[model samples]
Target: MITAIVHIDVEADRIPEVAAQVAELPGVTEAYSTTGDVDIIAVVRVAQHDMLADVIADRVSKVSGVVRTRTYIAFQAYSQHDLEAAFALGLDD
Candidate 1:
């Protein structure tokens, strides 16, 4: 699986709406409104590298109120145990 951490910038008042839309996308595992340089952060999982672009362009970019996005694709994962722990905690849906 290819994992992506997408940082999204949206209009302040539209943060919740944008986050809800993003979270409903097929490849998006989680989306949260945050207080930082970016308004929302989304985690996406794609079966292939090529599919990542589709998820970003078709799903993420199409969300209303989203101004911009920066996608960070994970290169090397360190520990499966950490991932498992996160899942066990119900962090990733």
Candidate 2:
């Protein structure tokens, strides 16, 4: 599986609508409105890397208020609780 974190820039007032659209896409596991350089953050999981671009172009970018996007591919991920447990045992080092 491939995981992508997509940062979306949308019209300020339309963030909620855009976020709702993002959440409905097939590959999107989660989407949320956030404060930063981008107005929304979406998590996309796909069966192949090439499909990632298709999801971004066909689904995410097609949303009414979306203006731009920056995608980050995740190499590894850990829950905060796992990280804390590892740190407490000095396993992270």
Candidate 3:
């Protein structure tokens, strides 16, 4: 799966509305309102890289009040689920 972390900039008064709309888009796993330079952070999961443009450029970027977006493709992911499973391989407990 291709994992995309999208940082969104939106109109000041429409952050929540924009985030809610983005969260409902296809392949969008989650959208969160956050602090700092970006207003929303959207997590997208897709089958391939080309789909990133379709999702981010065509869908996310066009959402109402979304001024712009920047996307980062994840090369590696580290999570507790992966760590726990690896550590439990030969352990009795």
Candidate 4:
């Protein structure tokens, strides 16, 4: 799966509305309202690289109140479980 983390900026009054709208789009796994440089963070997962453009530029970017967006393509995913497993590779216990 291809995962894209999208940082979204929206009109000041439309944060919730924008987040809800983005969350409903195809390929969007989740959309969160957050406190930071951006208003919303959307997680998008797709099967093909070209689907990114369809989801981000074509769908997400066109949502009402969406001012701008910055998308990050995930190269690797690390979790606490994965970290522990890696560290235990050569251990006896």
All candidates: TM-score: 0.82, 0.82, 0.91, 0.86
In every candidate, how many clashes are there? Answer: 0, 0, 0, 0
lDDT digits (tens) for residues 22-62 of candidate 3: 99999899999999989999999999999998999999999
What lDDT score is found at residue 21 in candidate 2?
Answer: 86
The alpha-carbon deviation from the true structure for residue 60 of candidate 4, after best TM-score superposition, in angstroms, is 0.4
Candidate 4's displacement at residue 45, Å, is 0.3
lDDT of each residue in 1-93, candidate 4, tens digit only: 999999999999999999999999999999999997989999999999999999999999999999999999999998999899999998996
Q: What do the candidate models score in CA lDDT, each in turn?
A: 0.91, 0.91, 0.95, 0.96
Instruction: Give the best candidate by lDDT.
Output: 4
Error of 3 at 71 (Å): 0.6
Error of 2 at 70 (Å): 0.4
Model 4 ranges with Cα > 4 A deviation: 81-93
Could you tell me which residue pairs clash in candidate 1?
none
Cα displacement (angstroms), candidate 1, residue 29, comes to 0.2
Instruction: Rate residue 27 of model 4 by lDDT.
Output: 100
Better of 2 and 3 by lDDT: 3
Instruction: Decide which is better by TM-score, 1 or 3.
Output: 3
TM-score of 1: 0.82
